[model samples]
Target chain A: MSHNTEVLDQKTLWGGGRSPFNVSYGKLMIWFFLISDALTFSGLLCSYGFMRHKFSDTWPSANDVFVHFPFMGDAHVPLLYVGLMTFILILSSVTMVLAVEAGHRRNKKEVQIWLALTIVGGFFFLFSQVWEWAHFIHGTEAGAIKDIIVDGEWVTQVVHGANLHHNEYGNVLFGDFFFFITGFHGFHVFSGVVINIIILIKVMKGHMDKTGHYEMVEKTGLYWHFVDLVWVFVFTFFYLV
Target chain B: MERDDIIEYSLDISHTDEEGKVIRKRLWKVFWILLAVTIFEVGMGFMFAGVAAYKDMLMYTFIFLTVVKAGYIVMIFMHLGDEMSYLKKIILIPYCFFIAYLLFIAISEANFIFDIGWVLG
Candidate 1:
C-alpha cells in the first residue's frame, strides 16, 4: 500500500499535467466522447437496418415519403428539399473549417465572418428539419385504413401520417425510428448552432484571441464536423436508401 | 507578462505565410468533394426513384458514397488525418469492431423475428 501511494504521489494524480499521447488532454477527452457517441449512433442505425431488412417488401420508399418541396404545392419533387438541406449543412461545415483555419492564423475578422456563416448554415438546417417534421406529422395525403380478410376476420391496416402507436408510412416502427433518429440529430444541430453562436461571440470580443491558440474554435469545428458526418449517414440510411 | 510572451500570444505570423494558403486549398478541396458526392447521390435518387429493379443496387451505392463522404470529412475537416497514426488507430479501430458486433446482433435478431413470423407494419 505504501509503495503504491508513493508511486501515485510521484506520477499519476500528483504529477503536472501531461499528455503521453502527444495530444492535448482536452482534445483526447473530446475524441473519447465522440467515439462513445458514435457507438450510440451505430446502435441506432444498425437496429434501423435490421428492421428495414426484415420488412423489406412493406417498407415505405423514402422517395415516396419525402416528395414535398417547400412551396412546390404537391409538385412531387422527390428528395429535392432534403438534398438542399444536405447541401446547406455541408456548406456550413465548409465555413466552419475555414473559420478554424482562420483561427489558426489568428485572423479575427475572418474568424468572425466564417463563424457567422456557419451559424447561419446551422439555422437553415434546423429550419429545414422543422419544416420536414411539420409536413411529416400533417402528412401529404391523408391515408386511409384498409380492411382485408385474413383468417376469416377483417384485419384493419393503416398506412401515412405517423403517431406513437401507428404509422401510415409502412410500419409504425419505421416512423418511430425516423422520428427518433432525425429528431435526435436535429437536436444535435440545434446545440451546435448555439455553441457556434457562443463561440462567435467570444471570437468577436477577442476573448478567444487572447488565448493565443484558438483551440476552442478547433474543438467546435470537430463537433460541427461530427454532426455533418452523422447527417451523411442519416441522409443515406433514411432518405436515400 | 513579458513583452516577448505578449508578442507570442498576440500573433503567430508564420501561420499566415504559405501554410494559410495551403489550408485554404485543402478546405476547398474537402468542400468540393463533399458537394460532388451529394450531387451524385441526389442524381441517383432522382433517376432510381420508383424503379424497383434498381433499388438494392442504388441503396448499396448510396451507402458506399456516404461512407466515402464521412471518411473524408473525418480525415480532413476534423483534422484527424493530421493526428498521429497510432492515435488515429486507437480511436477508429475499436469502433469498427463495435459496429460489426451491433450489426451482427441486430440483423440476426431481426432475421430470427422474421423466421418466427412476428412483424410490425
Candidate 2:
C-alpha cells in the first residue's frame, strides 16, 4: 500500500499528461518519417547491390566511369569531384546543426546566418549533380560498340553516354539505377532546401521568437542531417565500393 | 492541457555559452572525422584499384567506414544521441535487423541466379 502510494505521489512520466519520449509530437513524427525513408532508401540500395552482384563479371567499375573533372579536359581523376561533393554536404550538415544550436539559445541572427549557409551549400551540391548528369549523358569519344536490335534487324553500333534505352557502360541497368537512386536523392535535397527556406523566412519573421521555442528548426535540422546521411551511403556504395 | 501548453511543456531548449561552445566543438570534431574517413576511403580506392586479391577486403572496409560515418551523423547531428534510451533503441534496433535481412536475401538470391547462368541472359 505504501509503495503504491509513493509511486502515485511521484510525478508520473507516462501518465498521459506529457510525452513519454520527452519529445514534441512534431519531432517524434519527424524521426518516424526519417526511419521509414531510410528503409526505402535501403531497399533501393539493396536492389542495386543485387543487380551489381548478378552482373559481377561485366559490371562497370565506378572508378573508370566517374573520372571526369571540370576544367581538366580528358583528365582521369577518379572520385575527386564526388569527394568534393561529399565534403560540401558534410560541411552543410555542420552548419545545420549549428543553426539548431542557435535556436536552442533563442539567437535568431545566428540561426538565420547558419541556415542561409546551409542553403547555399545545398544549391552548390545540386548544381554539381546537374553537371555530373550532363557529363554522364554525353558519352566519351571512344564509346563502346555493341550489337542491338532495331526494327527487327540486328545492327552493330557505337553507343555513347547513357540513357534509359542503353548505356555505354557494360550493363544498361547501371544507368537505370544511377538515374533512379541519385535522382531520388537529388529530389530530397531540393525539397530540403525549400523547407529550409520556409523555415528561415519564419525565423526572420519572428515566428520562432513568438513561439518561445525553436523546435521547428530542430525538426528541419533532423531532416537535413538525414539527407546527409543518405548521401554518405550513396557515396560509398554507389561510388567508392 | 491546451495545445500551447503541451508545446511549451515539450520545449527542451536550454542553452548557455558553455553548452554552445561544447556543441560547436563536437560538431566540428564530427565534421573532421567524416572528412578524414572519406579521404582515407578515396586513398584506399586509388591504391587498391584493379587489385583482384584485395577486392573483397576493400569492399568490406568501405562498408564499415560508411556505417561509422552514418552513426556519427545520426547520433550527433540528428541529436538522436540525446534522445531517451528507449527512443534510440526504437529507432535504431529495427534498422539493424531490417537491413541485414534485406542484404542477406538480396545477395543470396543474386548469387543463386548468377550460379545458374541466368543473369547475363
Best by TM-score: 2
Task: List the candidate 2 regions with Cα displacement exceeding 4 Å.
Answer: A1-11, A149-154, B1-10, B119-121
Native-to-model Cα distance after best TM-score fit, residue A76 in candidate 2, in Å: 0.6
- Taken over the whole model, the C-alpha lDDT of each candidate is 0.81, 0.88
Report the error of model 2 at residue B9, Å: 4.4
True contacts kept of each: 0.63, 0.68
TM-score of chain A of each: 0.86, 0.93
Report the C-alpha lDDT of model 2 over A51-72, residue by residue, as the tens digit: 9988887789888888888999
The per-prediction CA RMSD against the true structure, in angstroms, equals 6.9, 4.0
> DockQ: which candidate is best?
2
Worst 10 contiguous positions by lDDT, candidate 1 chain A? A1-10
